[model samples]
Target: MHSSAVFLIEFGAIILGLGLLGRMAGRLKFSPIPLYLLAGLAFGEGGLLPLGASEEFVAIGAEIGVILLLLMLGLEYTATDLVTNLKTQYPAGLVDGALNALPGAAMALLLGWGPVAAVVLAGVTWISSSGVIAKVLGDLGRLGNRETPVVLSILVLEDLAMAVYLPIVTALLAGAGLAAGSVTLAIALGVAGLVLFVAVRYGRLISRFVSSDDPEKLLLVVLGLTLLVAGIAQQLQVSAAVGAFLVGIALSGEVAEGAHNLLSPLRDLFAAVFFVFFGLHTDPTSIPPVLLPALALAVVTAGTKIATGYWAARRNGISAKGSWRAGGTLVARGEFSIVIAGLAVSAGIEPSLGPLATAYVLILVVIGPLTARYTEPVASWVIARRRPSGPASAPEPQAAAEESGGAHDELADTVRHDR
Candidate 1:
């Protein structure tokens, strides 16, 4: 009874605190993620106040948060959208992987954390936060922009890549041998293929089966199904997040829209909890030691992400202004970075990885919005400053020659008329 009372008090306080923090962020016109992380730090191991009883409950909520995040992300598009993005935007995806992922891998190796840590860090740096990007797009009223499709295509491809990447990382973290890892990879691919096939061919059927007029029933059914699939996928050594995402992809039409609306509140709640949980496990003191490296990585990756968006948009023949907007929009890395690092930390791969990732994400998430808003104008300003003050000599000479020739021709025509 005493423990139950403690849990209630602690959990209640945490939720209330999160709510307040979220409201503060909303008023400040920024993401509440960093604030949530700070709160977790304060309540975590080395911070001002540590909670004893509600930690386990918070942990469970955090897992659910990740699941819901991937699931809702999946619902944002149909199977056709995914396939189209994979085919059309693959080059951008590859560029994104190479440009952004390499720095994290290099940093890990330099830190002597081994190849496994390098791979883990690569994922942490590779993915941009779709949730954050989408929110920013809406907030900035850029959803209707020409470059928006290019941005969405790139995000879709990244999410698809995650479906494949997560399984490989899972196998690696479990210390599986080559054969075991290959088997796990094959299974994951097979499951993903099967889900895609089903979603593409019979998504409406699946949705009809799950659909209901009652919101409560719909919510319970969707949530329960997602959890069941996620648990089974985890049991099979696949990513639970992937499983939830696949479940989401298998529903379409009104069912997908309805489920999305019903689950959004839950997703937000659990996602906040997940961020806090990540911070809870990280010691505040550890962040400072790794702050410099984190800052460096954030700066490097932010530029790469901008390049990625610009290249993708330019390839699509968007205007330079649109392309710049596209690049800036993709600069922020948020939830997925934390998710990847959280996996590594939970597996105990590297002790310092968590703190470094936390600090890196904090820097980027805050900088992301600012860059998205200013990258284009800032680039334009710099270019304008570097440009020559006057017209080029070549153009000036050509203009003068044309003017003189026109004058001579007019005089000749006048003389000919007089004669």
Candidate 2:
């Protein structure tokens, strides 16, 4: 077979395998991310499949995936949504961001990696996957709840932070030669900020043009704008994913109804390619003794975020139950984690670390959905136990209510009066 034909055949096979696994995963209530990573591992050097695709190409595809994912994520937000949620989102987001980086930094420092590597790793943990969480919640019929808007607000905040952090961290890891100086970096940041501001300010005008009843036109508009912003962000030394997300946020005010109709199908189609390509790139045999430490680090990476998310939500007046539910639901990592890992590779991090990161990612994708599922039960238990007792001057509502309206009358009437 011709080389191009051979590549296409191999790619098709990988996609087929992932689709089957993804279906099985959905039925079994597991996130397909872990399964994809496992698939990557299976085909990697030490595992079963061992297709020798260049990590560089896979990483490129992953970047596109990140950008597309962010674009879709942005589509879910609106200007009004941003304004309303900014208050609580800022603090919670900050805490989650800090929590993500600090733990990974500590772990990397302990492990004796370089400063740049430590920062990259720490920043990786800082992200929370709104896409994954929202999808899961929506599928489970939990998206319309009182807590969802607040959770989404925080997720948006994280996306903004990711915009700043991914680029800076990527530059740092790129080392001295690849580094953009403070002035250049500042200019890039300023330009991005301006673009976003203008986009938000005049979004209404753009919405009129892009917001069509036709799904195809709406998708074309979204894709065109997405690539435009992504291009701008790249020129400014930031990740295109950030550009896509900001554009999404800008459009959030008016994009949902029409844009959703347009893009959902595309997202589903491309999402499969993204995950399968993600699996194709990760080399399983490359992980070494440090694999053990990597898993431990992964646990801390996820745990710190969970704790911080809970703390932030509680601090913001969310009920303990709601806070726990939101925090746990946000714990799963997907598109963002892989994007950051790709950034690390672009910075010349060795293949060994990539495998370790994949191992770490495997755990997050596995645990995140399960954490979301059980959050309700756990939150309910916490809420029940923490209920305030009756005041000294008044009987407890529970006890009093039970006594006054107990099932006693009905049960007493039903029972025979035995002396």
Candidate 3:
């Protein structure tokens, strides 16, 4: 009885604290992800304080958080869309992997963490946070931009790649031999292919069956289906996230939209808890020794991500402006980076990997939004500086006179509009 009360107190305090942190992040106009992780650090093993009874509950919530994150991601697209992305976006995905993923792998090798850790770190850097990127796009009014599709295509392919990547990582972490790993990959790919085939052929049927007039029933059915599929996939040594994602792709039309609407809040809550949970396992004291490497890796990966986005957009015929915008937009990595790192941490691959990942993610997540806002503008400014000042540029006096007149007219128009 005493323990139960203590558990409630700890858990309740955590939720309330998270709410406050999230609210603060909103007002500050940044992702609450870093804040949540920081909060977790504050309450974890070697931080300001530690919880006794509520840790178990938090661990479970973290797992569910991951499932919902993937499910919602899957809900964003149909199997048809996946097929389309695969057909057209393979080159971009390859470039993205080579440019962005290699830095982390190189860094891991440099740190002497061995090949398994290299694979793990490579994944940590390869994928961008779809959640964070989507939110940033919406906030900045880039969702309707021409380059937005280019950005999104890259993300969709990454999502697909993760389906294969996670299972491989799982196999490696489990100490499976090359033979065992091959079998795991084979199972994962086969499962993924089957899910896609089913989704493409019977998606409507699946969604219709899950659809309901009652909101409560709809929520229960969708959530239950996702969990069941996720658990089964985990049992089969396929990634639970991959399973949840396939479920999302399998449900289309009204069912997908309704489930997204209903499950969004749940996704947010659990997702926040998931970030917090990652932080809990990281010792705050371990971060400093890794601070330099994390920063260096963050810088390199940020550049590579921008390059990947820029090249992808350009290859698809996007203009310099839009391509730069896409590049900058992809710089922020959030949820998925942590998700990959969390796996490594749980597998006990390397002690420093968690702290390094924590620091790396925190740095990038904070800088992502800012870079999205400024990268294009900064690029244009540099281009302007490099151009020779010919007769067209030498007309400052005339240009200023014309500009002043235009400003006067614009000010008059603004006054009339305001009136």
Candidate 4:
């Protein structure tokens, strides 16, 4: 077959394999990301069908996946959500994510990998895949439960961190050598500009447009603006994800439902291709003879992410059981880590370390979702066994309860909306 025909044939086969594997993953109660990667490994370079394509294509697709993923994530967030919930999640997510990721970096360095590879790998391990967690929680009817918001909060914070830090990390890895001073100044300016533009100019105007009959047109306008700002952010050497995130934040109260509706299908399709292609490109044969060390790094990823998130939740006054759930839920690393590893490999970093880190990330992505799936029952069982139940409350008092009740109501609304 001609090379082009060969490429098309392999690509079609990979997609078919992914669809079958996705069905199996659903039946097995696991996130499809890990299964997808595993399939990729089996069929990619070292396994059966080595297309021998450059890794850069997978890397690029993965990067776009993260960007669009964050963009969709940003649509769900609001300033109110952050101010109300992130106090506990942000610091905890940072500490836990860092703890989980750093050791992996150290392991890489100790094994003679370069510093950029270490940092890139570190950042990749720092994030939790909220999509996986939320799906698990919803399927189990645990979305309104006690630990749900905490998990959501941490995922939100992690996504925010990715938006802010991804560009800086990418820049450094690409050897653009961003100055700390310039980055700080740019962030300040960006925040200020966003505030002035939104609060002063667009806030009232957006309300009118939202109330207008031409909601579709309004969505197009908002999307155009979002992409424009994202372009500007890219021009400023900031992550386009950051810009898109802020735009979503600005429209949080005003145009969220519309924005999400418009963007979600696109996000899903692109994201699917991104992962499928990502798997298609990974050459399992290229993985070095460092399985022992890679496995060690994978253990660190699993242990520290779980422990740190657990500790953070405990410090936030969560029940010990809730903390455990939070930690377990946060353990999965997804597209961000893959993107980071690719960046490292591109920047003169060794392929051995990059693929090693990628390998570990795939393992965690597989395990994290399974842990999150049972968190609620496990937490409720643990907490309920430890503490006696209080007397049943009157409807009046229960209804009058603070944010907890509101959260339940919102969750109910979310379910209704989803259905």
Candidate 5:
């Protein structure tokens, strides 16, 4: 009875706190993620007012949070969209991986952490926070922007890569041999392929099976199915999040839309808990030791992410401004970074990795929204300032206008051709 009461009180207070934080963020016109992280820090180890009883439940909620995040993300598009993205935007994905992943790997090696840590850190830096990006896009009303699909395509490629990468990392951290790792990789790939095939070919059947006119039944069925699949995937040494994503992909049409509406609130609640859970495990004091490096890494990677977005957008024939927006939108790295760092920390891979990852994510997540809002205007201002003065600059405006007109005409032609 005592334990139950304690759990109730602690968890209740957490939910209440999150609600207030979210309201405040709404009023302030910014994301509540950083505030959520700060709250976690305060309640976590080495911080003020730590809790004892509710931590385990919070941990489970955090796992559910990740699963729901990936699942909902998967529901946003079809398997056909994924395959199309993989085929068309692969070059951009390659650029993204090389430009962003290299810095973290290089940093790890330079710090004497060896190859494994390098690989882990590379992953941490490589993928942007899909949750954060999605929220920002909705909040900024950029979901329908020309560059938005470009952004989503790049993110999809990264998520698909994670389906493969996580299994390999799991095998490596467990000290598996080369053959074992290869086998694990093969299994992950096979499962992913099967899921994709089913989603593409038999999605209508799966959706019909799961769909219901009753919201209550739909919610129960989808939630139960997702948790079951996620658990089984984990048991099979595949990523639970990947399983959840595949489940989402297998449901389409009205079923997908209905599930999204029913599950969105749940997704938000658990996602907040997940962010707090990340903060809970991190010691506040450890961050200072790595703060400088984390800051430096955040700054460098932010630029690379911007470059990745810009290149991808331009490849898709988006305007310069849209390309800049795409780049800025990809700057924030949240849940996955923490997940990767958490794995390494649990495996005792590197002592400072956790603190560094925490600090790095904090810096970027905070800056992400600001950059998304201002990157284009700022870039325009900088370019204008650098232009040569006098007669050269005077006719340049007319020439630039003509160039822009030509570009728009070409874009219109391309759009019509695509149609």
Candidate 6:
């Protein structure tokens, strides 16, 4: 009974705090992610007051948060859309890997951590936080923007790539032989291909089976199915979030709309818990020793990620402003980075690697929303300032309007208009 009461008090206090923080963020017109992270830090190890009873529960909630995030994101499009994106965006995924992943691998080798650790660190830097980026897109009302599909396609490719990359990393860390690792890699690829094929081919049938008139029944069924598939995917060495995403794509029309409506509030609540749970694991005292290198790494990879996004979006014919937004949206590294680093940490690969990954993620995740909101406008402002100030130096006004992405600085104008 005493333990129950403490759990209630601790968890209740957390919810209440999150609600207030969300309200403050609303009034300030910004994301609540950084605030949520700080709150978790304050209540975690080596901070002000640690939660003794509810920490475990919070971790489970965090997993649910990620599943819901991906599921809802999937529901926004159809299987056809996913297939279309896959066809047009595969090259961008290659560019993304080369630009972002190499830096981390190079850094690891430069630090003399060897090839295995290099592979692990490469993964840590390559992937962006889908959950965080999804949330930012929703918060900033960019979900309907032209560049969003480009961003989502890149994220989906990364998740698919993880199916293969993770098994190799695990095999390496376990000191498994070459043949065993090859077998695992083969299985991972086969499963990933099967999932995508099934999702695209028979999705309508799945939706028909899941469709229901009653909201309560629909909610229970969809949520239950999502968790089930997510668990099975995790067991198969696939990304649970990707599994959830497949489930979402399999539903369409009324069923999809109903599931989204029923799940939105729950998604928001658990998503906050997820961010907090992330902070709880990071011991504040461990950050300073590797802060400089981490900051330097974060800076370099951030630029690479931005460039990757810009190139991908532009290749798909997105406007300059839309490409900038797409690039900025991909800047934050969250859950996947931590997960990769955590595996390395548990294997006792390199002590400094874990801390560096932590600090790198921390810096990028905080700056993510700011960049998403301002990158285009800031870039536009800078370009405008660089232009020579004279009628003769500038082209015709009509020509300028045609060149500046459908209007003269539409991105900046949108920001100013919003303000």
lDDT against the true structure, each candidate: 0.86, 0.65, 0.87, 0.63, 0.84, 0.77
The predicted structure with the larger lDDT, 1 or 5, is 1
Residue 70 error, candidate 2, Å: 1.4
For residues 245-289, could you state the per-residue lDDT of candidate 6 as single tens digits?
A: 777777877888789889988988987897787667666777798
TM-score of 3: 0.93
Please identify which of the two predictions, 1 or 2, would achieve the higher TM-score against the true structure. 1
What is the per-residue lDDT of model 1 for residues 255-278, given as tens digits with 9 covering 90 to 100?
A: 988998889889999999999999
Total backbone collisions, model 2: 5
Candidate 5 lDDT at 298 equals 95
TM-scores of the models, in the given order?
A: 0.92, 0.81, 0.93, 0.77, 0.91, 0.81
| Top candidate when judged by lDDT against the true structure | 3
Clashes of each: 0, 5, 0, 1, 0, 0
Using TM-score, rank the candidates from best to worst: 3, 1, 5, 2, 6, 4
Candidate 1 TM-score, C-alpha based: 0.92
* Candidate 2 whole-model C-alpha lDDT, 0 to 1: 0.65
lDDT of 4 by residue, 316-416 (tens): 56665556766777777776666566556556557675567557767777777767656546765776688777984334332222214335547333322
lDDT of 3 by residue, 332-391 (tens): 888999999998999998999999999999999999998888888798789788987765
Worst 10 residues of 5 by lDDT: 410-419
Q: Which residue runs does candidate 5 get wrong by more than 4 Å?
A: 390-419
**Evaluation by TM-score, superior candidate among 4 and 6:** 6
Better of 1 and 6 by lDDT: 1
By summed lDDT, the worst window of 10 consecutive residues in model 1 runs over 410-419
Instruction: Report the C-alpha lDDT of model 2 over 293-384, residue by residue, as the tens digit.
Output: 77887677667766876776567555555566667777877767777776776567655456666777777777887777786577666756
Where model 1 places Cα greater than 4 Å from the true spot, the runs are 390-419
